[model samples]
Target: MKAEEMWKASTGKGVKVAVVDTGVNPDTPSLKGQVLTDEVPKEVSYKATEDYDGHGTSMAELIAGTGADGTLRGLAPDAKIVPYRVALTGLDKAEMQKAPHLAKVIRAIADSDVKIINMSFGGKIDLPDVREAMKYAHDKGKLMFAGTGNDAMETEFTGFPAAYPYVVGVAASDESGVVGEFSQHGNYVDLAAPGLDVPTWCDKTFRSYCTGEGTSMASAIASASAALVWSAHPDWTANQVLASLIDTAGRDWARDDPSTYLGYGLIRPRKVLENKDFNPGPADTDPLAKENFRGVVDESGKPVAASPSPSTEPSKGTETSDGDDQGDRASATASETDTSGNTTLWVALGAAAAALVIGGGAFAVIRSRRGA
Candidate 1:
């Protein structure tokens, strides 16, 4: 994406991204001064800095980590992170009960100064409560991104939150720009980003970085990309920010006919940043209104045939001891029960070496190779 050239214009300085996941570790070498714990709402905030499985910390770092102490730098280093802890699949039963409800958490973030909400996790079942919370956030004009899930190897069920209206579903891709086989595909996919073979925290210890990949990481990058565009034009509404991304995204197919694997193609924030005269269209008009208002389709881009709830199986986080095979792994956050009483699976993004980053001056650096 040659993001470095675009960084000459914006570094996502004034933007604040809400990392809605397990929890964000503020003490990480790269995130030392980036996390804003005090800004979090007291009611919804519980162990907001305690990362249970390293997934939340990695997503936080991917968006705003400062890259201090030689740790991985985020795509928007100048931006700030607001951490929120919610119940996921792998959390203890007692601890999960203590965590705030997903609806409350989303509403709190919607009322906050956060302009972007990055949910690198997803669930299979559609929960009305969660959907309502997301709608509230959307009404407040917030840009949200979520992983489409990493269950491409298995079934093609739509990942919740991402499948919801107005929430952009992001898919994972490699340096070569090919979508990962694990990235879930459906009409809900709004955009794609580098997700394969990226650097992430090895575990909750936050001691060292390891290679990992999944739609989770891709969602973080997409959120950071929006931060860059929004930072450059702070007055732009959420619709405008998203419209700019869809307008400037890289793709080989026609804009109207988006790819199921890569919706609107790989994100290229630089294209929007470089064009000072870019028109972002209407503020209230949603860029994804058609998909949201009309109806959703299956992985083949056909209209929804059936809604199946996949059983919650603990997937391993993608970790590779060698640079060879990238297999299934644990998701960043555990699966949680939806309103349907079904256990929802959150895609586990582990380590891989896909090129997802390019330099953007000193402030805009994602953990990927220098070229697209």
Candidate 2:
């Protein structure tokens, strides 16, 4: 994605992204004047800016960090963040109990003016209340994104919130467009983004950025990508925004036979932004209608409906590569050059070293215990 060129069109200005994660530190050098603390509802705003682990702040910075004082530059630096904190692994037991419920936080965000909800976290359990909350947010027309998960080695369980219908589940990929082996794969993955070797806050201290990999980072990037598209086409509804992404995503395989590892393909918001006259289909028609309707279990643990799948013409004029054979591993290491001329770690290593070699353990515990 030629981010600089896309910036010539839109910097995600005037868009608000609701980050439903651990919390966001408003005082961070890059986040100053970016996080909307007061906009968070009073009832579920407890410790909204107190990030126990550095993960929440990292995700926040990935989406909207202003890149001040050598900090990470966000993909949507001009967007605003409405932070929310919920219980996760490593939090003190008492504190975790005191945090607002996840469903309530989701509901609050649904009722707010936030255009996007970025949940860079996941869990194996699919709680009905959480799914209902997600549905409520969807009904309210919010564009939601979540990590498919980082524990592809330990479990094949489809991560929830990500598996929930109407939510865009994102998987991790390298700069070369190779899906990370650590990225859990399933029919639920809707898109892919760069996740390997990304710089992240090492801990709660926020002292330095450490190399990390997981679907968490991928989800953040996807959300920011949507922000850029939404900012460029302010009149487009959530469906249209998502449809635009699906229309222009980089993929090698037929769109109807989406890869289980990379989803539709690596998200390339630049393609959508570059085309001023791009048609995004209908505002009410879901791009993933077939996948959402087929074989998906609802919060009530029941099948909704089996609808005839819609047809998609193969995308032309974009780069293409062979789809990964399920469970095949490969290797490469690369750095991403930011607008400031800084070389940050972009995931290194091919498929073989994708899971065990990358040190993404930090995200595993947090996501696994999201609602435990």
The top-ranked prediction according to TM-score is: 1
Q: What is the C-alpha local distance difference test score of candidate 2?
A: 0.70
* Candidate 2: Cα lDDT at 361: 17
Instruction: For candidate 2, write residues 1-372 as lDDT tens digits.
Output: 666667789889999999887789999887999999999999999999999877788888888877777677778889999999887655677887788988899999999999999887766665778888988998898999988765564445666667888889887766666666567767777887777667667778988766666777788888888999999999999999998888777776666667666677778788898889999889898787766777666799986732222112221111222221111111001111000000112221232321111111111111110110
Q: List runs of model 1 lying over 4 Å from the truth.
A: 295-356, 359-372
Identify the candidate with maximal lDDT.
1
- True-structure Cα RMSD, model 1: 8.5
Candidate RMSDs in order: 8.5, 10.8
How does each model score on TM-score? 0.82, 0.81
| C-alpha lDDT (0 to 100) for residue 126 of candidate 1 | 72
Q: What lDDT does the true structure give each of the candidates? A: 0.72, 0.70
Candidate 2 ranges with C-alpha deviation above 4 Å: 295-372
